[model samples]
Target: MLGGFGTLPGKLIWPTSVTTSPDGDLVVKDSGTGHIQIYSPDGDFKQRFPYGFEPIKGMGDVTCMRSGVILVTNGTRIIQLFSKDGELIHELKSPKLTWPYSYGITVMQSNKIAVSDWTDGGKINIIGVDWRMNAILKTNAIEGFHRPVRIAVSKNEDLLVTEGQLFGRFQGCCIKVIDKNRHLKRTIGPRYGKTFSFENPSGISVDSPGNIFVTDEDRNYIVMFNPDSSLSAVIVSEGLQGPSSLSVMEHGLLAVADCYNHCVKIFRYK
Candidate 1:
């Protein structure tokens, strides 16, 4: 039985990423508190993993695998693997990454890990890590990125990136899809201009049916699109204030991290 949207005792301070483990446990990255919080499927507190080698430091995104291993970024181009019991197992460092602020991470079905390195160079760095958390292959800096924030992998192993850059008083954001070989496949959303469409697209995830869902932070809604880049529908257009991250469950259930609202909203898809 599904218990409605569960609440956290303390407010989630600057929650960045939320994902489910292979056992259906909910894991959240609290950037403000610089730690990862785990919750059981029933919304009970499991445990908290501190950042750095110290306790309660700061961390970036968190991605979990089916085998119960958790991957977290330290915002310093370093990825740390933690055991199911919250013990640091392994750590991998990226020397090419000078600026910390690496925002997004996704683990493929094959257990390969991919992360987005956001820097001032205006390029997106795609780093592929092996099962041991060692950087095996990396793509050249893909230019034309203002602020690559989030990333998602499709069923076909394609990469989708969200670019969020503030322009003037407005935030210009868009999504770009890349092939497995790190080639630009297609660009979604409006072209770069004054009247651009997306406003700070922060989160992205693809459903099993090949549908893409993105959280438009400024618009306060979740936008869905077909695999071919066509708009499908707006899942939620209201009752959202600064939706940051999202995770799609198995049975058409959607979870949106409502940042300003300080809660994760669970919705059943019809």
Candidate 2:
């Protein structure tokens, strides 16, 4: 079993993504600071990678691949690959990605990448890249999205997406589930108002048990749901200012990038 809320030193500035390395180290993308910070499981500072350039204006979102490589989205419809220690390994660019503002990225088991391009008519693209970040196989957008923010793949291979409303401000954003064939499975939430009871839903991750965890930035809480879209529980409701990205560690432990507070908070399942 995992315990809740461990203490850590150092601050993160405008952190956008949080991911755990295979070695149990917590990695984060600090957008404001233009750097990546690594932390031990116990919240000890390990190292920092400056990223060498501004990622927010150039890259929309960044994440660590399952194979331990880092993928960063370039606003110009390209993906940059970097070593875990912040070394520039390679880059992936395609003309198909114009006006790209990729806000989410996830690595599939097939070693391909599913990235969200948030543009006029938003799209989710699956791109195949080699070890050198070279493009292999590429697929077009499966569906037109309103404003896709974050993404998560279920154990059953289902793709889950959270949509953010462009107009109006309230909790009612919707979570859209799609099958492997890119077919829409169902829509969840949109319960509170036009926002679907989710205010600024950003980061999402799934546990080994097939439970889904979503960070409601405006609500300052992490919402958990079962595979059936039923409410399971609220994991962390306090000590968070703006939770952006989520990554699950071993033993049901969760790492959250609290953007506003400029710190990563770890929560354990009780």
Q: In candidate 2, which residue ranges exceed 4 Å CA deviation?
A: 1-10, 52-59, 167-172, 192-196
- Estimate the lDDT of model 2: 0.72
Off by over 4 Å in 1: 1-11, 52-59, 94-99, 130-140, 167-172, 191-196
lDDT of 2 at 197: 70
The alpha-carbon deviation from the true structure for residue 200 of candidate 2, after best TM-score superposition, in angstroms, is 2.0
lDDT of 2 by residue, 1-270 (tens): 111222232466667788887778787777766676778888877777666454344235666776677877645566778787768777777676543677788877677778876676567787666655366565657657777877788877788887765555442377888888889998777663233377667788887788888898778889888878887777778888878788888987898888777777788874
Expressed as tens digits, the lDDT of each residue in 1-270 for candidate 1 is 111233343346656677778887777776666667777766677787766431223325677877888888756656788887889887777566544666677887656666666566345555555665355555445666666777788988888888765554343378889887778898887543233378778889888887888888888978888878888777788998887788787678777777666566677664
Of candidate 2, the 10-residue stretch with the lowest lDDT total is 1-10
Clashing pairs in 1: none
- Local accuracy by lDDT, each model: 0.70, 0.72
**TM-scores for every candidate against the unseen true structure:** 0.83, 0.87
The clash number for model 1 is: 0
RMSD of 2: 4.2
